[model samples]
Every structure is written in C-alpha cells, then in structure tokens.
Target: FNQNRDQITEQLFRLFDLLSITLSLLLSMWLYSTQFSQQYFIAGTLAMLCYLLISSATNIYHLQPGRDINHHSGLVIFSSILTFMILLIAASMTKTTADYSRVTITLWFFLMCLFLIAWRVSFRRIRLNWFKDKRNLKRVAIIGANDIGNQIATSIKENVSFGYQFKGFFDDRKESDERTAKNLAGSIIGSFDDVVHSARNKEIDVLYIALPMAAEQRIITLLDKLSDSAIAVHIIPNFFIYNILHARWHNIGSYQALSIYDTPFYGAGSLLKKIEDMIIAAFILLLIIIPMLLIALAIKLTSPGPVIFKQKRYGINGKELIIYKFRSMTTCDDGRAVKQAEKNDPRITPLGAFLRRTSMDELPQFVNVLQGTMSVVGPRPHAVAHNEEYRRQIGGYMLRHLVKPGITGWAQINGFRGETKELQLMKQRIKYDLDYIRNWSLMWDIKIIIQTIFKGFINKNAY
Candidate 1:
C-alpha cells in the first residue's frame, strides 16, 4: 500500500508540474497575442522560470502529499509574490518592460496565481478522496505510546489526507501498567518484538520511533533490529525537554547541522521577511501618512514631550535598538526601575490611555520595520530593562531576541500582550514566543497577522 501510495503521489506531482508549465505557456501565448511582441514572450517565459525556481526554493512543491492546501496557502502566495517581483525586476533591468502591455501582464499575474491555487486545492481534494477510499493508504505504527507518540497519533488521525492508517503502538510494558500508553486508548497492538515481526512480514508500512530522548540505548537496539526490515523510520525529536525558540538547521560551508537554540530569520527566511516588512511598511506609511501627521499634532498639543517616544529595547541577536512608539506617558521609562502601566494609571495621559487600548501607539513601529530593526510579525521586543530583569527570572526569555522583534506576535494575539506583571505571566509569554519559533512558517505568520488585525489590537490587557 505504501509503495503504491508513493507512486501515485509521484505521478500527481509530475502532473502538477506539467500542468504548471502548460498553463505558463498558455498565459504567455495569451500575452503575446494581446501585446504582439517577441520581448513579451521572453519576459513571460522568464517569469515562469522564476516562479518555478522560487517555488522550489521555498519548498512549495515538496509539501507532504496529504497536507491541506489552506494550511500552506500563505507560503504559496508569499513565494508567488517573491517570484513575481524577481521577474519584474529582471524585465525592468532588461528594458523589456515596454514589450509587455501592463494590463496583460497584470491579468497574467492574477491568472497564474489562480491557476496555482486551483491546482493545490484540486490536489488536496484528490488526496482526501483517495484516503476515504482506504485502498491506497499506508499502515503506520508507533513505537512508543507516550505523550509525544499520542500527539503524533492524534495528528495522524486528524489529518486524514496523509493517508496513514494507524496500526496501533508497540511498547515493552503491559498496556494498562504503562503510564505512557494509558492515554493512547486502544492503539496498542503488541510488544516491541511483535512490531519487528510485523514489519518483517510487511504488515506495517511506516514505523515512527517515538521513544523519549532518555532511551538512547533502547532506540539504538531497536534500530539495529529493524535494520533488516523495509519499513521507513522517523525520529520524533524530544524538543519538549528543553526550551527552543526558532530552532532550525544551518549549513556552514558544506556541513549541514542542527541548531538547538536559534532564530528563524536566516538566509532566504531573512530576505523574505525583510521584503515582506518593506512592502507592508511602505504601503502602511503611504496610507496612514495623514493619520500619523494628525496623531503627531495631537500628541504635540496634548503632551509637552516629543510626539514619538524612543525607548531602548533588545532587537535581533540581543542588540540594542531604539523602538519607536507614539509618546503615551507623562514620563518615559527606559531604565531599570520601569513599571508597567495598570488600569487608570496616573502616568498615562488621556490620549495615551486611548492609544494604548486601541494599539494606535504601535503604529510608529512601522518605521522600525522599515529601518530593519524589527519585523511586521515576530516575538515582541521587551524593554532592555525588562529584558535584564526577565532573563534572570524566565528560563528562555533571552531567546526571544533570536529573531528581530515585531510590532505584533503570537503571544500578543493569544492575550499575552501588554504587561507581564508576574513571573508566571512572563513565563507564559516566553513559552508562546518559543512555540512560534519552533513552528515557524510563512502561513503561521499570516495567520497571526490576520488574527492581530481582527482581535489583537483591542485586547483588554493592552493597558
């Protein structure tokens, strides 16, 4: 079943690539007919090449077969935009801009985007339908029935498009007596040796070695025994044992290695983030220039201090950065004795209270985003004094600086925004920050950004 499924998935990918190329060619011909220029054909073909290359670089085509299209749509859109911009730049540099009609190019861009989206949606539907048929699914077994294993099982159950038929778990201990196997319900089939025998007999298609990190010897022994079998193996990293923020692999020279503690913004990720920030910041600045001017005037009239408040905060890599915000207090605090504003704090001006509540005060940070000191979405930067304080109290507070700080973040959207008055609150915020890093994706960033637009700006805890 697994071999058949793999073959089908491979065929589907080949079909997808062929369709993409065909569509690109069709669109190019349409543009040529509309504009009637040789240069336009060249430009369109170059654009298609750019899209394919960037899509590959971003792993858009390398997604797990059963993954939902909606879950990855944001990455698709982002990569598409990156591809479009690269093509546009290339066209401009080659002075081929005049060959393509602006209207036709615009239409082609929208059409290609629609084509890509439709293809992914169709693939998702087809995969889901195949899973429902039950004839093409892979039989999967878990090695351990612990929390991590159960979590994997739950995910497999939820994502039916992955076409994994859970064949139950294998543990050394008795089912009822095993604490780790308890929550797994009835998924346990037999002992570890039984799993080996089943694999040898081609009963299990895939085997997940979900053992805890402490069982290194047991894992090694299991691997030795399973070496003769044909089942695919995967290791579920025990990341829960240590706090990780944006952990990922890095390549130094020709050696690729994992980083237990790291930032997500590196290489293509950094470049993509900067491009996103620049685009967003530029649009925001254009749209809100007048509103910002009015707010500046209001702040100048309502308060005696400067309209913009610049405070010291930790940026990416623990670097000192001057974070900008609309002045919201009678007195600014950037020192060691900084105090968080509470409800009806006397230090907050009347306008400051309103700005803080509505998150209007954060608008100026778009400048920070443009200045390369921050991102449009990431772990929010804390005051340098607060950083100094929390680094001692929280286990991984300093790790938030792994990436550039953002105007809004997962913690902010999840109601961990505003003040961290207690040690527990700070710890909770750090936990979310680290989770964001561990599960970093372009789609996740877009989700957080959308959530922030709808509900994060008006949080009751913002004050």
Candidate 2:
C-alpha cells in the first residue's frame, strides 16, 4: 500500500522541484536587476539539469515517510550545494563564466537552497498532519504467530508513523485452545478462517504471511484463499533461518529469484566502489609515498629479507594474490603451517615490531588497491594457509572473499585485528567481515575509513 503512496508523492515532488528551480532563477534575476537574456536562459537550463541529476543521484527526491524534518532539510540543502558546484564546474569547462552575472548566480544559489529546504519541510509537515488522524492508515494483519511475526508486529507498533494499523495475528493453532489464546498477546486476534472472512468483508487492507519456507502447502492454501479478495498480500520469508550473506531478491528476465549467497557490489554500486577506492587510495598514496619510501629503507637496513614482503594471500573470490607488506619478520612463510605474528615473536625484527605496532607494514597494500587486487575498505585478506584452516573451522568464513580484500577493514578497526589465537576470536572477526559485506554502503565505508584514522592505526593486539 505504501508503494502506491510513495509513487504519487515522488511524482508530485518532481513537479515541485522543477517549479522551485525555475521560480528561484527568475526571482534571482529580478532581485539583481539583470535583464533575462539568452545567456540567462542557457545558464538556468544548465543549473536545472545539474539540480535534477545531483538530486536523483543523492536520493533527494526519494524521501521516505516519517523522517526527521531537520535531517530532510539538511539533505535538500546538501543536494542544492552539490548542484551549484556541478554548475560551476560546467561553467568553467565551457568557458562561459564571463557570460553569467556573478551577483545573479550568487543570489540564485542561496535562493534555491532556501526554497528547497522550505519546500521539503512544508511537504513533510503537511504529509505528517494528514496521516496523524489515522484516516489514511492501512489495516494490516500477520498470518503467522512465530518469532519473526512477533518482531514484525513490534516494529510496526513502535514506528507508528509508518501509517499501519496492526489488526492482529491470524494463526490457526494459537486460537484452537482457550487456555493458549488467553496467554497470547492481545494482537493475536483470530484464526486463518477469520483472516479470509475479514479480507472478504474488506476489513483488512494489507496481509503479511510470515510463514517459514517449509510450510509451502499452508502458504499456498492461504494464497489461494486471499487471491479472490482486493487486499494486498505479501510473504515475509524467514531467510534469517540460514547464514545469509547479503541475501537479496533479483529479477532474472521474467522470473523473480532470491540469492542465498551474494555480493552487494553489483551494477552501478560496483563502479561507485571502484571510484571511491581509486580516489581515496590515490590521495592517501600521495600523502604517504615519502613515508613509505623511508619505511622501505628502514626495513632494508634493519632486516635480512626483502623490503616489500609479497606473501600469497586469498583475495576476491578466494583467488591467490600477492599481498605486499613491509617485511617485519625474519622469515617469509606462505606455506600451510604459517604462524600468525605473536607478541614480541622471535621472527619479528626490531623495526618489524615497530612497523606492525604502528600498522605501517600494511601501507604497501595501497599498491594492491591500485592494482585492483584490493580495495581501500573491505574485509582484510588473510594468508592462504589461514584461509584453508579457517574455512573449515568457521561457518561462512569464505564469504568475505565476495568483495575485494582491503588494506583496512571493519574487523581491524573494531579490535578484531592481530593474532586470533582462540577459534572464538577468529569467529568474531569473520562475523564482522560478513557484516561488512552485508551492509556495504559507501557511507559505511567512509565512516570506517575515518574511524581507522584515529583508532585503527595503533592497536595493542598488533604486536
């Protein structure tokens, strides 16, 4: 039901945005007493095009219901700033900077920002007030009375602004006995038969069948019963029953299929991740090139081995890649029995200990990033020996390779770095890695990178 509402709201928003941009430009020109010329028309069109592009890319138009008005306004303002920046870039590239009035441009930028913020805040208030009386709310019912069903009920109850009126659960077993019915929550209203009865009577608007995949026959029967009604129905699959790694649904031609094991980096997301890795890696490499060279020299003078230690490690898709680090240990162990670096280990050179402690040894992985073998942010790669050993010990251990290995990762920043002596410690590390893959957003990656700058560099566990 929210889909239809959202579609309508989005269409209205697009029209409002276009009108706001046009009026803001005209107002700006009038305020600056500048004649509206052909140049002004060209500049206005360019600005409007940039605004639409930036807004769509940043999700400014796809405003979700029940968001904080302040946060919504901030996003609008930010999008406006980005649009202005793009317009400026376009002007510079086209060599048309002199054709536009500086005063008019400045006024238009501020005017547009003010109007955009005002429009969203006003729209939010109006929408919230209209839905506050519950007249526009949809009547919803859940079919199952299991854990996932209860969780869904609780979530809907907590988020009242979702405009859903929870009619209650419709489980057949729960309503069979008077004693069991009394112990159940007040939301467990009736049986499966009552669900069909209510839907036919138009008492329910949306029905959620929170049944497990095993109950295929029961689900199909309910589907058949509800098919005649005008009510909207949805199935909440219990994917939490398994070790789901970034599980999602996709349309393969005409058929809808779900992925039990998947990667989030697909389509435009993969390109965006690449761009992010390249830009950040290039900038960081520029900053640390001199220091990396100095560290290389120090390693050569203080150690008996190579300055750059190219060890075989498991990379994306569990492929073998040469992971580069400044050699901090006496031996290059890439064999099946490779030992993790321990506290003050004998194999660690004096300089190597310092490098590991400061995490300077991993700096050369930026080259791995540029080589496209690694990302600036992702699950940190492990040795081939470790991968083989842990793949058997830990569940979903190999899922980390779904994305490219990173120089710094979610686990490393969250105190799961260094030697994992206990199997539980390694399990916890893999949990964080899989979690990263599950919720891999550009903002999350940026947050991890910022956190790494402060806390990830000097971990006590990295001996």
Candidate 3:
C-alpha cells in the first residue's frame, strides 16, 4: 500500500539536511577563503549535531501531505536559531571561540537556515507535481460505509498531496438495506467479495476496514480472505466516535491502549513549555518592572482596594490558583456569584477603566507565569464563580484547564478576549482555546506573543 514510504521520505529528508548543513558551511568557508582547520571541523560537527537534534524535536522531517510552508517555516527558522545558540554556548564553555571566523560562521548559519526553509517549499511543490502522475497514486477502497470511513475519505479528498486515488466504498449489506442508503454518500462500487477480487486483480492497493468492534469475526474473515492477495489493510478505530481530545495510541505490555483525555504537554513537551514560560516571563518582568510599579502606585491612589487584585481561577488540570491583576475595580469580587464588568460599570475607577480597556490589569499575571501557575500564552482563565457557572453550561469548558491559564492567550490575540456576556461569544473563545491546545507548539506560542504585542493589548471589548 506504500504506507511505509513516509519513513523512507523522512530518512531521505534527514540525509538531505545533513548534506545541506555540511555543504552550506563549506560554501561559506570557500567564500571567505578560509582554510578548513580542526577547530572548524569540530565547530561544524557540533552545529550539525545541534541542528539535527533540534529539527527532530521540531518535527521538521515529517514532510506530511498538505503541509503549509508558512505555518511551518517559522519553526525551521526557530530550530536554526536554537542550533546557533547551542553552538555559541559550546564554544564559550570550551574557550574555543577565538579559533573560528565570525563572518564564515554567520554566513554559514544564514545559508543553512535559508536552505532548510527553502527546500521545504520547493519539495512540497515538487511532491505535489509528482503526485499528479496517475501511476504513482495509490488506489484505495474502504470496506464500510460508516462515519469513520466517510471521514477518512473526506480527509484524503481534501489533501490532494496524499497521492491517494480513492476507488469507492465496498459493503456486504444488501442492495435494498436502509443502512446502505443512509450511510453511503455515493453508490458502493461492489460487495465485500468484490473488494477481495479487486485486490487480487491489483486494482485496489490500500483497503481501510471501518467496521465496528462488535463485528470482530466478520472483520477476521475479511482479513483472512484479503491475506491471499498482496494488499495493505488498516482499521479505523471506533474510539474516535467519542470526542477525541489529544487521543494517542501506544503499546502497553503485549496489548495496545489509547488515551482519550490527554494533554499535549507530556514529558519533554512539559519541560519545553516550562522553560518557555520562565525565560519569556523573566525577560518581560525585567522590562516592565518600572511600569508595573508606577501602575501599582496609580492603582493604590485611585482606588480603595489593594494595588494587586487577587481572584481564584482554574489552572492546569483544574487546580485552583490565585490569579493576580492590577486593581482596576473599587469593589473586590471573588465569591460564588461575582459579576462581569460592563461598559459603564460604576465600580470601575477612572484609571481602572483605562487599565481594563488596555489590558494593563493583566500585567501582574506575568508573575503567575514565572510562578508556574500560568503561561504567557494559553487559554485565559476565568473567575472561579464564572467558571462554575459555565462548567455545566458549556460542553468542553473544563478542557481548557489542560494547560495553565495565561495572561494573554490564543483567544486574546484573536480578539476573543474581554467580558463574554453572550453564550456564543464565550463558545467561540472556547473553540479557539481548544484549538490552541490541540495544536500546541513552541512556534505557535511565539506567534501569539508577537501578535499580542502589536494588537491584543488594546481591545474595545475588554471592559
């Protein structure tokens, strides 16, 4: 079925990347007319090692179908920058920085980054053109006209670069059966017997069985029949019938297991997220310390309450934490029925109105980020009272707690911030929040942070 071609493509990409890294360095050295010495060799080796390691972490070798270059090139650039930093650190630690030529190294880094990013765009275009050849396309047939089968077909149809030419659905149901009419979007190509016949005739390359787990014996019989022919078969899991939230499959002992409710930040991802939060939060605190102090003084003078307002909010895994905000209201509300601020809420002090509108009230939550109770980017937390109110009212409301609450988030950057008085507004915000968690990546966090700096800070609906 050519399913294993992905691994082959990945290995090919790795080899190409290794050669480009080496060749880029050589090109730089030749341009500078510098002789290749032992120090340069060691430096180049270290750089290659660092880049390969970082690229693996970034999943740069996936080369999957429908990979948008704009969505991924930032990560390639990020890996390049990280590799450069590690190389610099290595040279400094070993006290060998003086041995390398700066111009050569700089040129090499730029060329390597350029080549890595450029090749992805070029390769995807080339692969798309290559897939246009009918001979290279895999003829796929699905054995069931179920929901799972339909979804798989939809995905394959949308992603043209998958290089799969779907033949049609095959089912054993009687022609007059109501299930056939209900489930089949198009007319079935033939019965299950016809599937085996097509496989034997080399007309179908890949077959996906989407029968329910209850039909184990029927599936076994079909598999036994298909085993006579050289064809690849896959089964779509029934567990997908449930709401899938970061579901993953793994081998547990001699058996397979699937985790339905899981966080994206597991193991290395957790460490990376923590490191990202710490570094960014620390750097921000340094720059905004003076402004924070000024804001605090202004809050104390303008309002009767404490400078920093505290409220309970859900953190990662539904753990309650004290969220800090500059006191932007005269009344401190943190009860079972705290109210949302409106446009002309009288409890808002004069300076508080500006703070709320500008989102300066959220500045103190940067401390929560460093304290590990929050992140620079995530699903923004709501007050405990409002959270409880919506927890039952919303379908996947609690899912947002899969990651730490953030000072600013995907919702904020997308203009989903401020008071969510209407149910639809909050639902849209929750949708974006879940989307962020589903597609969490270091580059995504960086993108959100950059966006927040430019436009997320000042929102008309924030109050």
Candidate 4:
C-alpha cells in the first residue's frame, strides 16, 4: 500500500511539473509571435533550463504541496531574473539578437513570469482542496511520541498539503507525564512493534521513525524488522548538533560518500559565479582604466611612494593573499599590530583621503577579481593583523574565508564596511557573512551588486 501511494504521489508531482512547463512554453510562444521574433524561442528555452537548474539548486521544487506559495515566490522570481539576464546577455554577445523581435521578447518575458506565478498559486489551491477532501491522502504513523515526533506531527497537521492523515504514534512510555504527552493526545496507537504489524497489514502508508539519534541500537533493530514490511520508512536526523548552512552530500571518485558542512561552489554554482565575476570585472576594468591611470599618476606626482599599495590580507580558507589597492596612505603597514585609520590620520595623503572616503581607492581590486583571487561579491577581506586580532575574539570568524573575499559584501553595505574598533561590530559583520553563506544564491549576489551601486560605495566609515 505504501509503495502504491509513493508511485501515485510521484506521478502526480511529475504531471503537475509537466503541465507547468507546457503552460510556460505556450505563454512564451504567444508573446513571441505577437511582439518578438522566433529568435526569442531560443531565449525562452534557455531561460526555462536556467530556471529549472537554479530551482533545483535552491530546493524550490522540493517544497511539500501544501506549503505557502507566497513564501517561495520570491525565490522563484530571483531565480528567473538571474536566468533571464544570463540568456539575454548571451543572446546579445552572440550577435544573434536580430533573430527575435524585441516586442515578442519583452511580451514573452512578462507573460511567462506571470504564468509561472499563476500556475504555482493555482496548483497549491487545487492540492489543498484535494487534501481537504481526504480522497487522495496517505495514512501516516509516527514511531515515537518524543519531542521530535510531536513536532513532526504538528508540522504535518498544520501543513495540510503534505496530505498526511495522522493515524497516531507508537511509544512504550507510559502516558502519565501530561506535559510531555499532551500534544501527542489520543494519537498513541500502540507500541513500537505494533507499528510494524500495522505497516505489514497495510494500515499505514508512511512511517516516520523520529526516534532520537542516541537510540542507535533500537533504531537499528527497528530497521531490521521494517525491512520485511512495505511501509515507507524515513529517519529524522538530529540537525541541532552543528550549525548547518546549506548542508548536502556528494560522492568523491566512485565509492567515497561525504557530507558537506559548507557550500559547494566548485560545481555548477562555482562555474556560474566565476563567469558572472569575470564578465562584471572585465566591464568594470574597462570603465575604470582611465580613472585609475589618473589616480596613479596623481599619487606618483604628489606622494613619494608607489602608485599602488599591496596589503597582506586573509583570502579564501584563511590563507594570506596580497590585496592591491590604489595607494591611499603615506605609510603602509603590513606587519603585526596594525592600527586602523582614524578620523584624521597623518599617514593618509591628501588625495588618498578623498579616494578612501569615496571608495575610489579600491578600484584596482577589479584586477584581483580577474586574477581569480577575489569575487565580485563576498565578505570583504581584512588585513592580516586584523584577522589575527579578531579570530581569537570572534566565534566562527574564520568561516567567512570559506569563500573568496569580495570587493563588497552584505556586511559592508549594511554599515559594517570599515574600522572594526568594537568587538561587537566585528561579531555583527561575521554574522552577516555567515548569513550570506547560509543563503547564497545567484539572485542574492545580483541584488547585492545592485544595492552597492546605489548605497555601498559612499559610506562615512570608509576612511
């Protein structure tokens, strides 16, 4: 019975996805034919593929059916924009832009986006109605009435789209403790062994083994017994142990399976980010070359030092790297016990003062982005002395190096850009860095880049 239910759910989900894709394609075609040319068909196809890839990466499609559509709609929009921009840029670069009509392309984009949003909303409504009818729901039973199991039951009950009929739980503990077993209520069907019997008898379609991780022996024993039954068994791992940020599993070579404690940009995500960085960096370099040359010449004429300053800083994985910036200070300190620039530092040159306040001195790091040592967006790299000073004081400070340091980051834009004179300020910056890692998305990177254009460049703390 469990197997049959799994097959049905799988089929239904596939059908829904197919219908969504079909509707999106039709909308694209209609918009293209009416306004844009046939060339946009290629754009539409590529956009769809990008959406699917990014959606999978972000787990948008894995959301249970009854979940709120509004909560995930923002993610969908972000993914769609990233995909659309990439395709649009690709089309322009290939010199095949004439293949599609501009009107068609515009109309197609607007219509397709609307279609995706509408379809998801409609799908959720239909699934909710089906679940309320109880005609296509699965009878689900919990193995333990512990905190985790109770929480799971509560979530299932609240999320009607999960389509789980709570048939109750099976625990050996006596029901005398009213506080612990209050939520479990009358859902306690039988003992652990009785769950197996009910599953074997095709009474329950799903079995959630929510026993604590410490009960390894009992869990193993139960799994061994469950092997003979046909019920779908799912074990809920204790995720409270580690601060997991987008945790996943991957295989090394053929047989080596390892769980990831950090993000994986080394795969497709890495490739996409790198491509974005290179393109943006190249454009920036071209635009700033003349201005950068003027600044270099001014520094050479006005100050007795090199036009560019190289400072020792912590790079990706906490490794030391030389960060290049337009020389802003008369005295360069790359050693231990470095002091941050104050309101009126005698070391800052006249031109350097203006550049630092305006953030023009950091323009040379676009070259670093091209050099593969930095990203267009990430936690801003700190001086080596600063890294040493803070790592001892800050918890999870080194985790920021999990990815390459960026020209601008979430912390910088939110007023944590420079001079961590206070310990709490550094802690706040590290928190933002971890948040970026926790919710790293291409759309987020783009959003940060956009925000930086308007607000990140000119900050009072920059000097």
Candidate No. with top lDDT: 3
Off by over 4 Å in 1: 1-18, 21-37, 65-68, 82-96, 240-291, 294-322, 326-361, 369-378, 383-394, 402-404, 408-463
Error in Å for residue 463 of model 3: 12
**How well is each residue in 33-99 modelled by candidate 4, as lDDT tens digits?**
6544455556656776777777655556554554446545655566667777887789889988667
Write the residue-wise lDDT of candidate 2 on 200-283 in tens digits.
Answer: 999989999888889899889889989999999988866465445346887999998777668889999999999999999999
Cα RMSD (Å) per model? 6.5, 8.0, 6.5, 9.1
**Residue-level error in angstroms, candidate 1, position 87:** 4.4
Off by over 4 Å in 3: 1-4, 172-187, 240-280, 283-312, 316-364, 375-403, 406-463
TM-score of each: 0.68, 0.63, 0.70, 0.54
In model 3, residue pairs whose N, Cα or C atoms come closer than 3 Å (at least 3 residues apart or on different chains), thus clashing, are: none
Two-way TM-score contest, 2 vs 4, winner: 2
Worst 10 residues of 2 by lDDT: 177-186
Clashing pairs in 2: none
Cα lDDT for residue 51, candidate 3: 78
Q: For residues 1-463, could you state the per-residue lDDT of candidate 1 as single tens digits?
A: 6567766765576467546645755675576577456775566567667766665555565647544465456555665677678877887888877766667666666766677777878867876887897769899999988887888888887788778888888987766674755567336788888978998999988999889878999889889988889988887878654443334667899998778887776789878888888998889899989988999999999889989999888898899999899999999988777788888899999999999999999999999999899899889988777889889887878888888889989898878988667898888888888888777777667667756766678988877
Local distance difference test, candidate 3: 0.84
| TM-score of predicted structure 3 | 0.70
Per-residue lDDT for 287-332 in model 3, tens only?
9999999999887776677998899888899988998999888888
Ranking under TM-score, best-scoring first?
A: 3, 1, 2, 4
